[model samples]
Target: MSAKPSGSETEIVDGGSVRRDHTDRFDLRALYETSQLLSSSLELEFVLNNLLLTAMSKLLSTKGVALLFDPLGSAYRVAASKGIAALPTGTDIVLDGIDTNDPMLEDDVPERLLEHGVKLVFPVAFGHREIGLIGLGPKFTKQPFEERELEFMASLVNMSSAAVHNSLMVEELKLANRDLDGKVQQLNTLFDLSQEFNATVDRKRLVKLLTFALMGQMMVTKHVFMIRSVTGEGDNGSNMHIVTAKGVRKEDLDADTIASMCAQQDMVLFVEDGDSEACDHLREKGFRLVLPIRQKGDTGAVLCLGPKMTGQTYQPDEIEFLYALGNLAFVSLTNSYLVEEQIEKERLEEEMRLAREIQERLQPRELPVMQTIDAASLALPSRHVAGDYFDAVRLDDDRMLYAIADVTGKGVPASLLMS
Candidate 1:
């Protein structure tokens, strides 16, 4: 069961009986009801809507608007409104002198609000700072606001400010949570790719694996991957080469573009919307960001990412993941190069061993056992396959001919040339 609310009260003062006035008692009930309704929910829009409606009803006004100050943006935005020209919620109004936290009449209101038929402005405040404004138009009766009415509106704003602040806090927290969820997803993808990178040794296949990972997880549609040469060729300075391309072509990206975009190898570059020639050129190519990979204090590789299919800019952690992926791919490719080099070195060493053996055989064995003047000779190869040879032949009746030679080079070529 519910009992009807009463506005009657009694007080014994000065040894006499006195009764509380109905208007004062009624105002108390209204304030209590307004506070209860405002506190019922933390939804910002709901709270602001109810607040605007209550202010309109109390003032008997035809138009009203709820404006919340955005400290970060340094402006006020329309949170809710009634009977006014349609200004969408969150539309910014950059009015100055609004932070005075004082009630404003028609003459005191800004010209902008005056155009919207706002006749009164009440500041919504908590502690020392005013967070918002409640603007009311003229009453339906066409009469000016009374002194008590102004007082009541101030009281209503004071009561509702706490609820609005709480709602704003909750909304900000939800946004933060959303950003964190994205970060976790990206890191998990990186973890899986790291394992795959370890197993991949072929450069072409490694690049394919990385490209697929970006397309699947990051919603990347257009991308290019370029890696600088590690061999240190002085004549060419060893510029980076395009290893993979999706929507972009190898010829479209010149050497200067890659070098300029990757100037800051330690950090990612976010393409800003601008009129500069470089920026316009990148935008024309559909590239949105550039991620550089560092090796020995130099730009070793770069991953040029185009816009996502969803048209969302890359988040901070997403950029971090791409940079890490580029580095991982580079490490795997470097290892592949080293493995191939080792195999080649071993093959050449085996060829050298065979050449040395042949060279020894071709060398004069025992020098034909010369019996002239007790002649003797020995030819032992050093650690290398040198082009060394020695021989002596008797040229008819005590005339002797001898030949000895050592090639300038070593290894298989020298041994073959000497033979």
Candidate 2:
């Protein structure tokens, strides 16, 4: 069975008796309640506030109190307080060594507290670590804290330390969960956008769809689609050209400037107000980005997206999303252009095959056999039709003449002239 708490008393000098009062019983109950409440609370701020209030109400019975901690700084910072009229969020009290060993002792503590009439202090500890210090002002009942009150306060600190540790773990878990959820949502949106954008073959329509889709999904304020000629024959010095734009002036974009900015085969991003020397021209033109559209080793063009519609600075996650979007867009655009080129190539090949067949029919199948002269002639066509021609004519009295000549070029014109 647990030992019953005795209402012990002691005699002091000056004809005064130091008796354990009813307040001590109340203090024990308050300590138990504080432990129970803290055990259930997983919030760090609630645990701190509850600990401060409980100490003030039970341990010293102070009308006002403040809790300070070593922020590992030059002074003790107030972490929490109660019953104070005005307490700054960050208030420090300097320490002077009255007693070198016990800094929390009343005589060794700050003079500012002594001037303010503070009487008692409790040094909070967890294992070997001194977590903080709690200063209690003069008691509301005008009595000093006895030994029993100090014991109860120490027990409260021990129980509350476990709660503080658990609350910190819970807070960290909450932050990690939020970050994971954000990444998952971004990936899901990117996947859906990629599938939708790649389903079409029309280059112009694909770019427009991708631009509008990204603007709607990514919450961008503006979008610009640029295309570069692989053969590089245009008014712009570089092959980069803007195909479509929204929320920016057409004249503001310069292909040469964008190419120069993204010279080292990397994507460019600008989300904040200021601009570097590499991007100052864009800032002067009130543009935010000149993201490169690249595929393989080739720098095709750029897709410039402006600041987010929310008007807040772009976070790291947003920049990552833009990088991913640019990659996917580059692949899709390259695929569409490649498909178009293949179709054109196949069409030209078919035309060349038909022309070759027509030219073959026009050529002489068999040369006239020459009986007088003991000679034979034959012709063979190369993979592509060429301009070699040979013919034999019968002359008077069985005298035969044969001639062979080569034309200048190959293909239909050469084949026609040879015919």
Candidate 3:
């Protein structure tokens, strides 16, 4: 079967007659039916079943196995088998110390195969490439397989080799498509979550959404969100603190453990199956994931998750979704922080304006505005709002008293003191 000269096509050079490999076939119609049935379907199992049945009927064998080459593993595994209880199906075989890819029979077949009741070990090749092996036990009549029977088996295997290769390719294609669809659906989900996250600007409410998303999507219960202070926290500092948490008590979250992870994962960290000490420590604490939200060039916040309720390892796409979610959280939190800061700045500005006005009122605006001794006065502090006091008092008709004093400090406080 393996790129060897076909037995039926051989010519006898030593004798005047050419002997073709022949079997006691009823007619050409039976061979035609065998060919048509095996070629009818691209289903590997169906093809293997019909092929093995045809072999057993033609050769009267009681045990058989269809071994197909797995290209990825570079080994042969049993695809189908029957009546061979001693041989383990589904386990790959290396042919253990075999020399040739050519078909072997009788004493030439390896001893290990002999132990498994393999009377015939032939390769099924398509064009120039051998794709599989056919192993058969001794015939039920206890007779050894004849050369003619082996020749017929080879023809049947060759006819089905093309179908077998096609079926394997189709199965691999189906798996690849399924994986792609899963990733695309995951992306669509992340896109929708991003929209929701952007619309919410309140940090507390945004955190709640993030928490719910993780729990609902990942089926996680024990989790914490450690948000680094936007104004002060950084990879070099301990300003990161748990802003929201569930299941885990506050006391159990060690500060050093949290800070160490923050420093290590400056951009992002998915803690599943990592060998680093920080990752190991986190895993030991029952936390399986840590995602740090990037703000500027540092870690702005982090979300740590415990073991999933489903108890499954995180896939690549799920980890990617977490990265997307973290970025959305970063933007929302930063916007909320900026809005609060601006509001506080405006409030302080308003208070300063009011204090400055009070200081102006305390000054002698017109210096009595009277014709008593042609008196004149002016007062101006060296700063925007300062503590300074000066006044002139007219008594009766001819007496007058002028007073001046300086108060401590500046800005709003000093202006209030001057009054």
Quick one: best TM-score, which candidate? 1
RMSD to the true structure for each prediction, in A, is 6.7, 7.7, 7.4
lDDT of each: 0.77, 0.66, 0.73
- Candidate 1 lands at a TM-score of 0.78
**Candidate 2, TM-score vs. the true structure?**
0.64
Of the two candidates 1 and 3, the one with more favorable lDDT, higher being better, is 1
RMSD of 1: 6.7
Per-residue alpha-carbon lDDT of model 2 for 309-334, expressed as tens digits? Answer: 78766677877877787777777776
State in Å the error of residue 314, model 3.
1.1
TM-score of each: 0.78, 0.64, 0.69
Error of 1 at 73 (Å): 3.0
Q: If candidate 3 were superposed on the true structure by all CA atoms, what would the RMSD be?
A: 7.4
Please give the lDDT score for candidate 2. Answer: 0.66
Question: For residues 217-268, could you state the per-residue lDDT of candidate 1 as single tens digits?
Answer: 7899899877776565311233676778898877777655655555653366
